[model samples]
Target: SAVISQKPSRDICQRGTSLTIQCQVDSQVTMMFWYRQQPGQSLTLIATANQGSEATYESGFVIDKFPISRPNLTFSTLTVSNMSPEDSSIYLCSVARTRGEGFSTEAFFGQGTRLTVV
Candidate 1:
């Protein structure tokens, strides 16, 4: 099992500003992903960060808007670039635990960074 921690539990930022959130895992993980939860909305996967390759972003999310960096196992960062009021949401970091044969188990999520853009 792995434990995930996120920085800046909550914050308020001005529009057009950007915020970088950090995620740390207690153990090395093979699958690390970033998600976003809009107000009163379900979680949306932003991207999956590969250990040594560029992150694979979801359909709606672009690399320029949500750049991700995974330098190594157990660590990653997600930056919400050029924030807007619509970008206000809870950004969560998730890591999936794997079982035998590379199958994934339940995913663990961090406390999340609640950013409110003004």
Candidate 2:
């Protein structure tokens, strides 16, 4: 199993500020994903990080807003480039885990570090 740890469990930042979150895994993985969850809402995938290549961002997210870096298989970093009240959300780190045959894969969340931008 893969375990992930994140820092700054929660933070309250002023407007027009930025926060950088770090994600570390216990084991080497082919890919790592960054997600954001609004209060009482489903997770939204922000980007995918593959070692040795630039991170691939999903629609609606630009590299300038959420820059990602994957220097190795077990480590990655994401920086919320700009801050706004709308950016307030719970950020989560997840990795896909393989399951038994006929069963779908599952994603593991890192308890989610809540970020509040005022």
Candidate 3:
């Protein structure tokens, strides 16, 4: 299993601003994923970042707004751009660790960053 450490656990930003969240894994990981969780809502996958490659953003997400950077196997960053009240949410970083047979893996998550855009 990997231990993920995320920074700026919570913050309140002004409208039209941006926040950059960083994630660091104790061990190397093949893939890293970023997610957003609105109040009383389930997790929404924002993007998947792989080391040495461009991150793939999910539908309703765009790089221009949610840019991601994975510089190496154990580090990645997610930036929420042009913030607004509607963007208030908790952002999380996660990585999956597979063991033994088929598609069986345990995912580890960081202590999410709660952003309140006003």
Candidate 4:
């Protein structure tokens, strides 16, 4: 199991400003993922960050809008650029670890960063 921590649990920002959320893991992980949960909506995967390579973003998300950085195995950051009211949502950091051979992995999530744009 891995322990995850996220900073700035909540924030209120004016429209057009950007916010960067940080994710830290207690143990090294091969892959780290970022997600967004809009109000009243299910979690939507934003991107996957792999150390030493460029982050792979999901459909409907662009690198310019949601830039991700995975500097190492245990640390990553996601920056929401050019904020808008539509961007207000809970941003989550997640990592998965395999339970055992032939078994599915268990995902661990950080206490999400809630952002509100006004």
Candidate 5:
């Protein structure tokens, strides 16, 4: 199991400003994922970050709007660019680890960064 930590657990920002959220894992992971959970909505994957490669953004998410960096196996960051009121949401960091043979890996999530854009 991996323990994840996210910085700036909550914040209130004015519209048009950006916020950079950091994620740190206690153990090294091959793949790290970023997700967004809007108020009253289920989590939506934003991107996948692989060390030494450009992060892969999900549909409806563009690199310009949400840039991700996976500098190493245990650290990654996601920056929400050009913030808008619609961008207010909880951002989460996730990692999946193998459980056992014939069983699927379980995902571990950080507490999440709650952002509110005015």
Candidate 6:
């Protein structure tokens, strides 16, 4: 299993401001995924990023709002643009790690960055 860490465990921001969170993994991974947990909801996929290529975002998310960057095998960053109170949520980082014979799709999530936009 790989260990993952996230920056800024929690933060409060004003509307129209932005924040960037960083993620780091102990081991090199082929793919890194981003997710969001709203105030009272389950996790939702934001995007998936691999080194040397652009990220693939989910239906509700767009590049202009949630920009992702994976510069290497073990690190990545996500920036939330033009924040608002509605944007407050727990942002998490995930990655696929090998588990059993079949490609293990097991995901490791970061502690999560809690953002409160006011």
Query: Where does candidate 3 stray beyond 4 Å?
Result: none
TM-score of 1: 0.94
Off-target runs (Cα >4 Å) in candidate 1 are: 100-104
For model 1, what is the C-alpha lDDT against the true structure? 0.94
lDDT of 3 by residue, 1-118 (tens): 7789999899999999999999999999889999999999999999999899899989999999999999999999999999999999999999998888786888899999999998
Better of 4 and 6 by TM-score: 4
The C-alpha stretches of model 4 lying farther than 4 A from their native spots are: none
Question: For model 4, how does the per-residue alpha-carbon lDDT over 51-118 read when each residue is reduced to its tens digit?
Answer: 99999999999999999999999999999999999999999999998887878889999999999999
- Ranked by TM-score, the better of candidates 2 and 3 is 3
On lDDT, the stronger of 1 and 3 is 3
Q: Predicted candidate 4: what Cα RMSD to the true structure?
A: 0.7
Which ten residues in a row are the worst by lDDT in model 2?
A: 102-111
Model 6 agreement with the true structure over 1-118: per-residue lDDT tens digits: 8899999899999999989999999999989999999988999999998799999989999999999999999999999999989999999999887778897578898999999999
> Clashes in each model (backbone N, CA, C under 3 Å)?
0, 0, 0, 0, 0, 0
How accurate locally is residue 59 in candidate 3, as Cα lDDT from 0 to 100? 98
Clashing pairs in 4: none
Q: Against the unseen true structure, what C-alpha lDDT does each candidate score? A: 0.94, 0.88, 0.95, 0.96, 0.96, 0.94
Off by over 4 Å in 5: none
The weakest ten consecutive residues by lDDT in model 4 span 97-106
lDDT of 5: 0.96
Worst 10 residues of 3 by lDDT: 98-107
